[model samples]
Target chain A: EADIYQTPRYLVIGTGKKITLECSQTMGHDKMYWYQQDPGMELHLIHYSYGVNSTEKGDLSSESTVSRIRTEHFPLTLESARPSHTSQYLCASSAMDRNTEAFFGQGTRLTVV
Target chain B: AQSVAQPEDQVNVAEGNPLTVKCTYSVSGNPYLFWYVQYPNRGLQFLLKYITGDNLVKGSYGFEAEFNKSQTSFHLKKPSALVSDSALYFCAVRAKAAGNKLTFGGGTRVLVKP
Candidate 1:
């Protein structure tokens, strides 16, 4: 199993609320990513961090922002939540400089009520 | 841009029978392909990956994938189906141009009958 962990496996909140998804890894990987997946849909890359102090937007445009202050932590924050933001957010990590296996944490299933 | 495609959205196979999940990809340069399986309400588990060299690669739980350069396809195959294998399977690829950020397909639901 992956050493990565995501807090609040399930979350239900009202619209327009500020929230954050926690993603932590113990493997000290340089590459971390966030993918948003709707039911029976493709997983779209939302955000990623190459290392501490480095973040980049992914293929899919998202309103969320991410921070990588530590090597093991890459947290995504939403300035304002909407119903459309509800989906499974998966966190994954992989070693950089080579093609390595990616480890994934149990996704956080968010619901906007 | 690099992309992967899973032709079958869902595949059902009889228990003990062989099964295959199709995947095709397009990349500008060298391709790194991977397969992952997800059970209900669980995290995705790495099944296998094809980086270079050998066309056929084996992975965890007796899963294997064959990389075909001419076809630009990497199809996952299992000699026998298991009920436990029922889950969503995703085909992912990372193009040389895009670094190692993986792009996933829509995924395929594999159901094995008893």
Candidate 2:
């Protein structure tokens, strides 16, 4: 089984609320990524981290910010959630080896009302 | 720009029948292609990938894919389908000229009827 885990399998909150999605991996991977997906839609990369203290925004624009304070943790935070932000958030991690496949978490489904 | 395209939005097949999900790609250099499956309310799981070597590559869950350089396509195939195989499949590509970032297709939903 994949070691990556995402907390709050489902969440529903009103607009303007602050929220955080947690992601952690025990695989000792250096690369971590966050992706957003609407139901039945393709996943869009939102944020990624190369290692502890290193983060980068992905191709898609997102209001959420992520922090990589430790190798095992990469959490995404939304300062103010909105209805448009409601979606499924997925977390993944992979070894630095080129061509290696990534392991993914079950995902967190967020609904901002 | 590097991109991956899964032309079909959905595919249906009866159990025990063969199945194929089409995918085509465009990249500046040699493509690193991958296939992933996502069950309802879950994240994507890696099914297979074609990095190099032979055009045919076998992967997890009795799945296989063929890489056709001439066609610039990588299509997922299964000899016999199972009802439990129903899920959402995604095709992704990363160009050698590009970085490690992967560009994913819209996705294809597979429905296997018993």
Q: Candidate 1, residues B15-64: lDDT per residue as tens digits?
A: 99998999999988889999999998887899999999999999988899
- The prediction achieving the highest TM-score against the true structure is 1
Note each model's CA RMSD in angstroms: 0.9, 1.1
lDDT of residue A24 for candidate 1: 98
Task: State how far residue A46 of model 2 sits from its true place (Å).
Answer: 0.8
TM-score for the first chain in candidate 1 comes to 0.97
TM-score of chain B of each: 0.97, 0.97
Leading candidate by lDDT: 2
Which DockQ values do the candidates obtain, in the order shown? 0.75, 0.73
| TM-score for candidate 1 | 0.98
Off-target runs (Cα >4 Å) in candidate 1 are none
RMSD score of candidate 1 (Å) = 0.9
The residue-by-residue lDDT of candidate 1 on A1-113, one tens digit each, is: 78999988999999999999999999989999999988766799999888999999999999999999999999999888999999999999999954687899999998988
Residue B27 C-alpha lDDT in model 2: 91
